[model samples]
Target: MTNPTNLTPSAFTGARRVATALAIGVLTGLAQAGALEVLVLDKEGKPVPDAVVIVVPSGLGVAKNPPPMAAVVNQEKMQFLPPVSVVALGAKVRFSNNDAWDHHVRLTAPGTAVSANPASAEGMSLRLEGKTAGKPAYSAVLTMDKPGATGAVLLGCFIHGSMSGHVYVADSPWTVKTEANGIAVLEDVPEGSATAKVWHAAQVVDKTPQTLVVGSTPAKLTLQLDVVPKRRRG
Candidate 1:
């Protein structure tokens, strides 16, 4: 072992240089990573929850928190428990009808106008029998494997026109659903330029994507939709 008091001047200087280099390296690594806090609002300036926020960095990057590969959407009280969901492309989505009455699951591509007869619509359709006492609710799993099926899928019921929901298949891994406060935080983003896109179920027209820069420091952005979202039933 080297004695501390007998250390030479040159040895002390070498040790100090190594320590400084290590500190600089750590800072450079941190500078390469960044974070963003996104807020979604309506035209009325009110927070819009359940909105999908996707961040695409200019450089090669991976999502620190990618969307789930599998999810379950339950039909309860004549409505989908989660009105909106975000999942990875080619994910498996399970639809379970927990209600006592039968319900039909109709899925259509985003931007497809609702047809007068939902059953006649062009998309995947299935029927789930009502749940019985002491038995598990009927569920059907559908894989979103269609080519170019990377956006929102409109969910509705043929028997109950009032029932509606959405399943968003994210093309990018850095996708998140805003919380009740209309906030979505994305971390571990590559520092540099990136595009941010927001999607809401109630928006008839898609909003334009916004460009922003990410640096060592955290950043915040606010995106507003053209229309206010309708409140979901209790």
Candidate 2:
């Protein structure tokens, strides 16, 4: 009985509001019984942490939004908000700096590394021009033109070497980033064997497909992902 779109935060921008509205409509239409709730679990069975879970319907029932003119990745406190991002193919992303200093944004071609790769080719890099405190956020737009493309783009600040984030590009709009509670909900899944993929940084914990069956009543599903500690190298 919870309104999915109602969960949006007050800080949501115009585009986010639009996206949330569309997502709610799509989810409402796909509500049904017999839905499978999946848990993306590690080998130990605890909830996998910080993983993005995406549900792609087998049928062509999902609506597609026209690629937006631009997309934005905000910079604040020498860090990227939403450290992990997933956007549709051909969409553009704008890098916005909220901090007083400048930020250098970079990206990698989709599907380059498994997130743990030591060396990966840099996709592209750009700097965000600074803005006054009261001015609207300044953004650098990056377009994703290639279809069937997926990858994690690393973002960093020139002033802060330790700052980094990931930009995940997918072919569809079913992508959902995990929350602090470690839950990524994909609503309006069609009735059939649909595949839901979960990715953390560059590591793919759940590439295996999950089956979703839709009916007349609302369906609930749960997925679990494992968070493995990064191995240190000399």
The list of candidate 2 runs beyond 4 A from truth reads: 1-50, 63-70, 109-121, 132-137, 202-206, 211-222, 229-234
Off by over 4 Å in 1: 1-31, 112-121
- Backbone steric clashes in candidate 1, count: 0
* Residue-level lDDT tens digits of model 2 in 2-64: 776776576457668889888886865633323333444544554554466666666545533
State the C-alpha lDDT per candidate. Answer: 0.86, 0.59
Model 1 RMSD, rounded to 1 decimal: 6.5
Q: Write the per-residue lDDT of candidate 1 for residues 1-234, one digit (tens) a residue.
A: 978989899999999999998888675453476889999999999999999999998765656888998999999999987999899877888999999999998888755533213344467788999999889999999887666668888899999999999998888888999999999999888899999999998888988999999888998999999998998868
lDDT of 2 at 74: 80
**Minimal lDDT window, size 10, model 2:** 113-122
Cα RMSDs of all predictions?
A: 6.5, 13.1
TM accuracy, model 1: 0.83
